[model samples]
Target chain A: MNRYVKLVNFELGRFMKVYIALIGITIISQLAAVIVVSKSYLNNANQAMNVDHMAIETFIEQYGRMSFNDVTNSIFFIGPIALCIVTLLIYSLFIWYRDWFGKNTFIYRLLMLPTARLNVYLAKASAIFLFVLGLVGLQILLLPLERMILQWMVPIDLRWDLSINEMIRNFDRLGIMLPYSIAEFAIHYGIGFMAVIVLFTIIMFERCYRLKGILLGIGYGALALIVFFLPVFVQEFMLYNYFYPEELFMLMLVTGLLVTAGSIWMSNHLLTRKIRV
Target chain B: MIEVKDITKKFGRKQVLRGVTFTAAKGEITCLIGINGVGKTTILNAIMALTPINSGQILIDGAKINKKSYEKITFIPDAITMLPQMTIGQSMQFMQDFYESWNQERATELLGFFKLKPEEKISSLSKGNTAKVNLLLGLALDVDYLLMDEPFSGIDIFSREQIAEVFTSHLVEDRGVIITTHEINDIEHLIDQVILLDDGIVVKAFNSEEIRENEGKSVVDVMREVYQQ
Candidate 1:
């Protein structure tokens, strides 16, 4: 196997325990959300028909039927996803800092590895990407199971059925994570990957220069963002919306690639030449 | 041969190494003697390329250090570099996974020599044992050059003796070894060359045997004369 792949596997193994816990939390919370939301809706229906002595048709007219949309809106449903995202974002910085600040100076061993130092940086980025994708895949798999639980809890007449597609499309956050089209998914995640790479470069700067490097890292990150958005700035202000939407998108894509390449090159230089352990 | 030519380093406004120059030949043990905070460890770190030098060059066999230089030269820092949570076996396995130069046979032999258990977690080890494990990891690597920083610092007498025994053993034979230490009594006779560092420069570099034979002075006597002056 390639050393980079081995490094990725090693990085993943280090975080395996926390990653498993995140998956477990997402599963249990999302499933509980479906059951809880469905049961409460049923209780409301029973109260309307029996306690109020209202007809079933009158009760149905007054209260809308329950669907996966209700469960998706709850904290129990979105909270775990938010937790996973936050954990991963924190992990991006932790992955590098841990080697330096852990019980021992493992950064020494990492830098001493008989391979290009960039492999260490790239391997960490790959691990974070894998973790994010893995969680997204888990969410996709859990949706149908959650829907099944909802169907089992709420009676047929009292509930509105929605396919997995409808459930995801109805939830704005879920739609962002699991885009309907492959192109949108690629574009969304490509930008996400670029952000992560830039963040890693910033981390490299900090590691190289310590206190002064912190400001340098932040400055580099801001510069990258400005460069990435330059096309939109030019299109809106200087050209007065002269470029078509597709042309603007193309220009942004070029800028994004440029920034991503620049970050990687800078990180490589820092790792190989300027890094301190 | 490892040639460090007039290397200078600065930490903030403090200059740590000021045009330090020295060379250690293959099959010879070169001891860098300095008091506390005299850039002994810094020189070793420079040779391994762990820290960048501001000016001058370090060449291993006439070429500069690179990724491949790691396979040829390894540094055993004052402390173990493996994660404390890792067991001795897992730490060794990690080294094997990364370095093609890792010698499992020598590693196992060192484990027995140090009376260390593979199942033992690094965090659980005593200070002496941890140092032993650190030395074991570096000694097991089939590298031509080995740079050790303060190997005997803050260790028990027995552990120090056990570690000193490694120098005479085949594990270090034919390898270029550079060790930094303020306390030189234990291995005074073992080292072939001595580089005395003071205020970040090589005050004296000489063959130990020649100094003893010609000057009629022990390394300690020479140290007293040079430092007192």
Candidate 2:
């Protein structure tokens, strides 16, 4: 058991309660959205055929068959997912601040651990990444279950059934989360991980110098963002589209790695030499 | 030996430590005596590397403090460092999880010595009990050097006495201990050396036995003469 792994487990355990609640909320809210959307679609179908004296074919033609897309678009479904994203984003900051501002000063113990101080920084970033991935996995698992409930409620003739793949592709946000290809998934999440690392570095700056550190942190973050996007800036403006798409992508990848490495190096320096608890 | 040589620190415009220097041996108890806000705790923090000093060198056995220094030395701050939501047992477990120097046997003995239940949450402990637990955490570490900051600052008399008893016990014997406190009446005879700090510098530092034998002065009498001057 590496100390970093142990630290990650410890960090995860601290947030286990809130993590479980987020999972529970996502499951319950998404499931309820499916049911509510299905029942309402069915009620509209029955009213069109019986109350309006229209044929079943005519009713289907008018309302359009209900699919998982309707449920995905509802607030019940999107709200929970948004909440999870917002909570995790906030947790990324809260995780560090909590140790400092909690009931007791646990930062002292953390800084005093008999390992590289960067392990503490990296472990915290790992925990936040794990939480985000866990929620993404949960959403993937819940899609089929949600589809089953929708199938059970809506009549076969009046419903538009979609496979799990079709359902995800049709919804915009879900597609972003569960990308169509493995390469896109890797790219999306690699950038996400880089952002987290950069944010952790900013937090390190703030912890090191307090009020002055806050300004220093924000300035560092902005510099990192500009550095990461420099390739695109050069591609669009200075090069005048001189580079091919693949070349531009490669250039961006290089810059992203540079920024990520720079942030980690800076965070390590601050943690080991400049940090105060 | 722990040698803190000519360390200086500044908190913005306010200079807290000015060329402060001292040394504590492996088997001596060095007490840092200062009034409120006189950089006593700051010096202890500097020794532990909890806070960075602007200019100085602190060496434990002629080596700089690093990650491994934590295993050889530990600091018990004035306040508890564990989360309040953690139970006494969980806090001990956390210590075990991190520090290879954590001594569970000594920890358990300290628990009994302090009459603390493992199941008790830290948030629910009284001020005296909390101080005991804080001391227990540091004392249970099998390290050569221990830096304690204001161990008896705001505790009941009995708790203070119980904590004072730890100095004479085997838990601290043969180990270097640097403790900061303004009140010295309780452990006047226990400490081997005294470093008197005033306005961020060492005004006087001497062995208690030597001062008493040569000048017929208790630690208090020397303090009165220096402070009143």
Instruction: Output the number of the DockQ-best candidate.
Output: 2
lDDT of 2 by residue, A8-48 (tens): 99999999999999999999999999988888888888788
Provide backbone clash counts, one per model.
0, 0
Question: On residues A136-176, what C-alpha lDDT tens digit does candidate 1 reach at each position?
Answer: 99999999998888888888887889988898899999999
Model 2 residue B217 lDDT? 94
User: Where is the poorest 10-residue window by lDDT in model 1 chain A?
Assistant: A52-61
- Please compute DockQ, using alpha carbons, for every candidate against the native two-chain complex: 0.83, 0.85
Chain A only TM-scores, each candidate in turn: 0.97, 0.97
C-alpha lDDT (0 to 100) for residue B74 of candidate 1 = 94
- Cα lDDT tens digits for candidate 1, B168-215: 999999999999999999999899999999998999989889999999
DockQ of 2: 0.85
Q: Against the hidden true structure, what lDDT does model 1 obtain?
A: 0.93
Residues B88-166 of candidate 2 have per-residue lDDT tens digits of: 9999999998889999999999999999999999999999999999999999999999999989888999999999999
